[model samples]
Target: MKISSRFTVAVHVLSLISLNKNVVSTSEWIAESVNTNPVVIRRVMGKLKKAGLLDIRRGLGGATLQRNLADITLLDVYKAVEVVEDGELFQMHENPNPNCPVGANIQDVLELILFRAQDAMEVVLKEITMEELVKVLSKKIG
Candidate 1:
């Protein structure tokens, strides 16, 4: 199964806040940019706030980054949004037939590989910070 959209949306929200530091990034305003409902933005914003990535204001005050963009990484956003449970990114089908050689051995062989894959991905994510991403975004928009 694919990872949830919440991760990307969180990144988008963070990027928007970084780019438009002067603008009040209300849930509705962020929703407009993401082409989604304000409720979705609010929900994602709530998670981001809980993760200490964002500081959401009460009422109409809107939201802002809690930490510098340079301090945030894609992995930070990934975990913040809870796209997948810790160490459970690639889930295997439950109850492989013990009688079958392939079924019995599949999980054993695949688990380590999947974990390594996930770890590798996290490594890449950790290397790239939000500030780096925003720089790419800025170049693209110009």
Candidate 2:
């Protein structure tokens, strides 16, 4: 199961911001860290800005964290990506076999399972904060 790229980018960018604080980080630099296009970085950064996690400036300007690192968690970062709706991860099937009892109930069962799983994941994510993420980055980068 692959997570969204936007979530990954947000974590990375926010981790940098958590470490550097008010120092504006360029999209180019973030792109380099992720090894992706700056355009993609900008697009994701825009979403983060809208979520109030970051402040984006134009021109040669860049971005910085808008809130305190201790106040930001992995759950907040992931929520910025979007809510984890039921069956969002599993995806409901439209063409279930009407002839089979199992097929008729698969969608409902899967939906419940997926919802629970997402909730469990969110619980774990909520425990991780930007401060923890920055510490991990520091170990890897410095």
Candidate 3:
């Protein structure tokens, strides 16, 4: 029921890139900012690149955004690194008690609720762009 931290890390990496748009973002520097290993940052960067959210260069080079911050959304980042099965953002428990009416019915009810919740979440995430995040961070740092 837990989402991987890859999504957050990807966002953090992208944010760093956005903030330092004039300069290439090295994995080492991004890793330092994320408090993670360079290898981890590289892995997430691969995903972002594949998603067309980033442009990565070879050795001695670094990463950059493929598009403006306003063009990217958290859901785009989520889809890039999320490893969920069946493409579901949420999962339901397996094997609800068939004999129990409540247990049997609960799964269906939960599915509907969880689906709606995920939809609502994506809607909000869609509303938020990387531009908004960078602005917020810039204000805090300055």
Against the true structure, what is every candidate's RMSD? 1.6, 2.6, 2.2
User: Residue 93 error for model 3, in Å?
Assistant: 2.4
Q: Which pairs clash (backbone N, Cα, C closer than 3 Å) in model 2?
A: none
Per-residue C-alpha lDDT of model 1 across residues 1-142, encoded as one tens digit per residue: 6889998999999999899988899988999999999999999999999999999889667898999999999999999999888758887999999999999999989998998999999999999999999999999999
Error of model 2, residue 19, in angstroms = 2.2
Question: What's each prediction's clash count?
Answer: 0, 0, 0
Residue 106 displacement (Å), model 3: 4.5
What residue pairs are clashing in model 1?
A: none
Work out the TM-score per prediction.
0.90, 0.81, 0.84
Deviating ranges (above 4 Å) for candidate 1: 99-105
TM-score of 3: 0.84
Which of the two candidates, 1 or 2, achieves a greater TM-score against the reference? 1
Total clashes in model 1, counting residue pairs 3 or more apart in sequence or in different chains: 0
User: How many pairs of residues in model 2 come into backbone collision?
Assistant: 0
Query: What is candidate 2's lDDT per residue for 1-142, written digit by digit as tens?
Result: 5776788878987876566656668888878888899888888888788889888888858887888888889888888866344326656769899799999888888878888997788889999988887888789887
Candidate 2 residue runs with Cα over 4 Å from true position: 21-23, 83-87, 97-100, 139-142
lDDT of 3 by residue, 1-142 (tens): 5778898999899888888878779999899989999999999999889989999989767998898889998778888886554566766788989999987799888888888888888888788888898899899999
Give the TM-score comparing model 1 with the true structure, all chains together. Answer: 0.90
